[model samples]
Each structure stands twice: as C-alpha cells, then as structure tokens.
Target: MITRRDFMKFVGGGFASAMALGGYAFAFEPLARLNVTRYALTPPGWTPGLKLRVVALADIHACEPWVSASRIASICRQANDLGGDITVLLGDYATGMNFVTRYIHSSEWSKALAILQAPLGVHAVMGNHDWWEDKTAQRNGGGTTFAHRALSDVGINVYSNRAIRLEKDGRGFWLAGLEDQRALIAGKKWKRKHIQGLDDLDGTLAQVGDSDPVILLAHEPDIFPRVPTRVALTLSGHTHGGQVRFLGHSPMVPSRFGDRYAYGHVIEDDRTLIISGGLGCSIGPIRFGVPPEIVVVDLG
Candidate 1:
C-alpha cells in the first residue's frame, strides 16, 4: 500500500542507518575499546606457589591517524604497570597497507616499547611484515635487520630461532623464540639463504631440558601445530582476531588452520596456545568486533 516516494524514503533511511553502523565499526570501536585479557595457565614445570606473569603486546603498527608513536608509548606504560615477570613483543612495528603508509622508523617503536618493564626481561620476535618492505613492495631482506637492530639497540632481546633460560624464585624454565614462518617460506621461494637461522626451530629447542616446561614465542598462530609437546604453551599474534568478527567467527582468517585457532586460547591435547588479538591493523585500519589489546598470562 506504499507509494513509490514512500518506498524510496524507506530505502534511503535504511542506507543511512547502514552507513552509521559502518562508521562505528571503522572509526569508533577500533579506537575506543582497548582490551586487556588475563589468562591463568599452569605449565608442567611451574612452581605450585609462584605466579609468573607474562605480558604480550603485538602488532603495534605505528602509523599516523590510527596508531601513533605516543600511543605505542602509552601501550607500553600500561603493560609495565601490569607488573609482569616478563614481556614479549610480537612484531609489526611499521604500518601496513599501501594507503598512506607512514615510514615510522623502527627506532621510534623501540623507544616506545623499551618503556615496558618486567622483572625477568623484555623479549621480541619479528612478524612477517617486519621481513617485507610493505604490503606490495619486493622483499629485499633489509627490513629484518633494521627491525632487529632497533629493538636490540633499545635493550629488547630480539630472538630468531633462539632459546633462553630463566630462573625466577627458585623455578627455572626455557623460552624459545621462532621467526615468522611466512618470511621463511618467502625466503626459500626467492632463493635467499641468509635467513635460514630464523626458521631453525629444532636447533633452538635442542638446548632445552627434556622435562622442563618450555614456552615458545611465535608471531603467527599457524606455527602452533609444529611446536613439540615439551613446550607447554605458545604465544602468538598475527590474525588480528580475524580483524573483523561476526557471530563469533571471522570469515577472513589468514591461517591455513582457518577459524579453528583464529583468536584466544586454544587447547590441542597437552599443548596450549594463546593468540593475542594484536594492537594494530593491516590492509585497512578498521576493526569491528575485535578491539586492540595486550594479553597478560599468569603461569601458576
């Protein structure tokens, strides 16, 4: 019973409502809600009474109009205030996407992340973005060195297929840092042989004790399955919580593992993997259901 004019008005109103909702998703929610989630995990070698807090901050794509250097520093301060025993940075320091990619220096991000404090130490591992120049540029291999130097210069031990032993309050365990798997694959494809050290997981784990509980630091969650059973937990970030989630599932997860291990805690038999939603954006600076975050894991 509606006239053509009335129908057009209804259509226009629906379009306007949709645009408003899109604006909130693209602009409001991404910047407003920064979440910090706490998880309680008991690894095999963890002492009964001692609680070790490990804070992880990932994907700090320090770019303009979305993530600034000041914001990075603020994020570090927040993580430090959490009183963590150790802090791990999962990398993506430079901004992504060809749209207005600001060449925010690696040192700028390191200076911000160095503000983080932990009793044990602050460690970092490179992300795929760190190995590549930009979303579209040809891979030349200098980005990895630049990224590592920046963090190392600031005293954040950047690891590539490396393991370190830590003794805290009479309890000792091992931590292994693995390089970004995508970078490894790309290197192999391009016949680049210099970066083989980063992908050597077996060599890195060879130093750990057989019975000691180990925590592995991997930037991408896709590496979770390859981790051995000796490793009690693996910390990762790269999917960005699918960057957008609808009805508790993300349609565009970048993993071959698909939605099975997109975000949050996932248990596969005896091994537990915790994937951070990460703090920045790639492709586009828009996050819908997923908010930027830092993850705090307490090992009891």
Candidate 2:
C-alpha cells in the first residue's frame, strides 16, 4: 500500500506540471503558431474559367510582447506568397488598452503591409479598435486618419462604406468594403449627435449592377445577419477566434450572434459568411487552440 505522504507528494507534483503546461499553452504556443486556412468557395452558379483568390488578414495588433513590425512584415510576405488575386485587410492594427500597451505608429505597420499586392488589388476596412485613441501612447485623435493615409500611400484602396468593381478573366464582381458598424453608431460621444455616414449595405450595392456577383468586407461579423440574400459572400474578422477554445468550440466568442457567427464559414439563406480567426492577439496577448491565421478564400 502507498503511504499517505507519498500520495500527497504525487498530487502536488501533478498540479505543478499542469500549471507549467497551461502557462506554455497560454503564452509561448500562441506567439509561435501561425496557420494558413484555405477554403474553396463555389457559390451556386460557378463561373467557368473565372476565379478570385482573396487573402484576408485581420487583428494585427502590432504591439510589444506580441506582434512587432518585423513580424508584421513577415506576415505580409506570407500573404503575398499565397498568390491571391485580391488581398483584403480587416483592421485593428493598433492595440486598444490603457496599460502595458507598447503601440507602434500606424504608418510603420502600413509600411510592412505595403509588400502585399495582387492582380485585382488590395482593399481594407477599419475596425472599432482603430477608432479609439491610445491614451497610454498619447496618440492623438485615434489612428484612423494615419492608418488611412499610410495604407493609401502603400497603394491600398481604403473603403469606408464603398464598393469597388473587380474583374478577373473576363468575369466581373463588385467588392464592397464596409466600415465598422459599432464605431459609426455606438459610443457616448455620438449620443448627442446622430450617427452620420453609417455603412449602408443598400447604398454600397447601389453602385453595382444587379446581375453582377457581390462580395462584402465587413470588420465585424455581426453584420453578417443583416446582409441581403443576393450577396454571394461576406468576409469579416473581429472575434479573434475567442482567443481560446475548448473541444473545437470557442467559449468566449464576442458577438451578438455568439458562436453562430463566431469563426469560419457558415452557409445560410443562399449566402456564405466567413469570419477569419485573425492574425494577432488582443487584451492579454494570450491565445489557446485558436492560433494566428491568414485566410485564403478562392471564389469561382
């Protein structure tokens, strides 16, 4: 029979081992793992000999202890190597926090992302975090203006509730990039005045002809439900795959729709919604189960 003291010692050792493993999973694993997720999107009426490869990256919180300018550069190169016809960057380039945040200038992050290019072109949309000013860093007026200028300088077509037409191999489609829904409507400051210049889905669609295929780029997937059935696909990122997951299901999905629109592709009502897991961390800069990723969606 085992002695009582020996049993206690064994239990103590087991607990310590578990703590060490948990720390590694929460801290070290997240920093090193980067996944390239691929999806072949065949939207009912497949256009022959016409294909659109779009590489989507989002939530690149370029800050210390997590993402650096060098890491951002490497990510851009990785995205370029994917051979996408169009590259869409969903925003949140800067971290949103008042403590322990080592933020980089939006321009520097843009310089790294400048390496990304495609035949159709590169497009981007802003996120809610991008609109909040960095108090700790003393950055003025958020970072939207800087980010827009930086991305524009790098040849990226930054769209705010706008649609751009793209053609590939004699096939054409309209790509709409929508601004952050919450940023436009939410916030205590906006309470006094009506939210102007909101991202209107119908307004965006008005620019394109009815017969052409349409793809929407919205930062938050919560808007996915409001998207019309006519749209073939909607790409979004913001949840960051809940930062942690258990049993293949993330327990902390941050959306009004919860896990219903959490991450990955969901086909409902003749439309496809794809929410990227994203390429960086948020809050504590710790991720488990869900690693950084670049989403590659091929639409044909």
Candidate 3:
C-alpha cells in the first residue's frame, strides 16, 4: 500500500523516463532513405535528336538527425550510378547558418560533398535558406558576396541568374539558373544586391540563342508564373512537398498560393516544371508520406 505522495512521485518519474526515451527515439531513429523518382518532360522544340538523362537533386538541408555528410554522399553515389548525362542541384545545400558554421563543418560533411560528381557538370542555384543566412560571408571568410565557393570548389557551378550550355551527341541545350524569388524580393531595396529578377532570364537566354532548348534551374517552384515561355523546362525544390504528408496528401505547405504548388511535376502552357520533394527535412525532423527524392528527368 503506497501513500498518495509516493504514488504521485512514481508516476512523475515514469513520465520523465518516457519523455527522455521519446526524445531519443525522435532524434536518433534510423533515417529511412528513399527511392529516386524519375519523370519525363518533353518541352516544345525539344529536338528528337537529343536523348539526355538529367538528374536533379534539391533542398538537401544537410543537418543532423535528417541529413549528414554520409547520407548526402550516399545519395550522390547513387545518382552517379544512374549514369546521368548531367546533374543539377537546386539549393538549400546546408540547413541554415548554425548548421553550416557548426555541424556541417566537420570532416564528414566535407567528404560527403566531395563525392558529388557528374560528367557534363553539376550546376546549382541558391535557395532562400542559403541566401538569407549570409553564406556568402561564410564563403569569403566573412562577407556576403555569393560565398558558395565551397560548393564551387567541389565541382558545382553555383549559378545566380546565369546560364551554361551543355553539348551532347552533336546537339546542345542551355541550362540557366535564377536567383530565388524570395531572395530577390527580400533584397529588392539594396543596391548591388545578389538577388536578381525574371527580367534577367532574357539575357541568360540570349547567350544560348533563342532556338536552343533551355532548362531553367530555380529553387522555389512559386517562380513558375514568372518564367518566360522561351524556357523549355524548369526544375525547382523548396517545398519539401510538405515533408510530413499523409495518405498521399501534404498536410501543410508554406507557399502563398496554398496547395496549388504542392509537389511533383506541374506543366502550364509550353513550360514544364519538375518540383523535387527534396532529399532532406526542414522545420521538423520527420518525413512521412513525403519521402526524400532524386529526380531523373529524361529528355528525348
């Protein structure tokens, strides 16, 4: 027979123990790696003579519990195995400021990033997280001037409103990257800002010639409405496709237009957009229906 006080003490102790266990389970539970998703998008003027395999990975918020260097390397290795003609990385390479300056600075993270390689070259753009956290400063050893040199050093072409052309099998296509719309909006008032506008697309396209096929690399899918029809296809990732989805439905999305821009491929008019669910978590540590992804887009 226990006194009331003793019973209450026992209950509190059990509750505390359960909470501790729960916390550990939530943090250290084995991360479930996901299968790569493949899709085909045939844009207008896409030459039948060109058969290209392009692999795109995005929104890898490489933080602890969800994404580590080893995990990112594994994903890269798998992509490499797929024998893609080119690999494109949409942004959010590092989780945030604290994670980049702290956890991701470890040797494992560096080693993981080193594993990312592709034949035609790996191109990328900055995500809202990368731009907002002042990684440009981290790149220059303390000054916000597009400091993604770390990624560049590891063979990634970090493009901001820029274009590069890839020639394959005697045919060529233009790959262009735009600064994230959020970053552009946030830095609108500043002069000499890193952010750029959709107007820059005209100049980027000019370099590749108007008739050439062009694939635009942008981080946020919301920018879809702003892209010109001259762009054959656009690839983005920033939604995480509602990381913790249920019953094949996303419970929440952060876009201003609600669920209209939830996830996967959305084509309007002549422009084809592929939105990757991304390869890591954001805002939380769990992913249910929305598993991470490596998108392979076949262009023929």
lDDT-based ranking, best first? 1, 2, 3
* Candidate 1: stretches off by over 4 Å: 134-144, 184-198
Q: Count the backbone clashes (under 3 Å) in each candidate.
A: 0, 0, 2
| Candidate 2 wrong stretches, greater than 4 Å | 1-3, 98-101, 134-144, 184-197
Query: Which TM-score value belongs to model 1?
Result: 0.90
Which tens-of-lDDT digit does each residue in 155-196 have in candidate 3?
667787788778898888889987666553233333435443
Structural similarity to truth (TM-score) of each candidate: 0.90, 0.88, 0.79
Ten-residue region with minimum lDDT total, candidate 2:
134-143
Q: Could you say which candidate leads in TM-score?
A: 1
Q: What is the lDDT of residue 237 in candidate 3?
A: 91
Candidate rank order under TM-score: 1, 2, 3
Cα lDDT of model 2 by residue, 1-300, tens digit: 999999999999999998987887666766788899999978854456678898999988777657878889988899999999999998877776433346788788888988888888889988766654434312342334556677898888998888877788778788898866655333453352533224677788787775778889998888877888768889999899888877768887877677888788899888899989887776666778788999999987
Residue-level lDDT tens digits of model 1 in 225-288: 7787788789999899898989889988878788987899998877899999999888887898
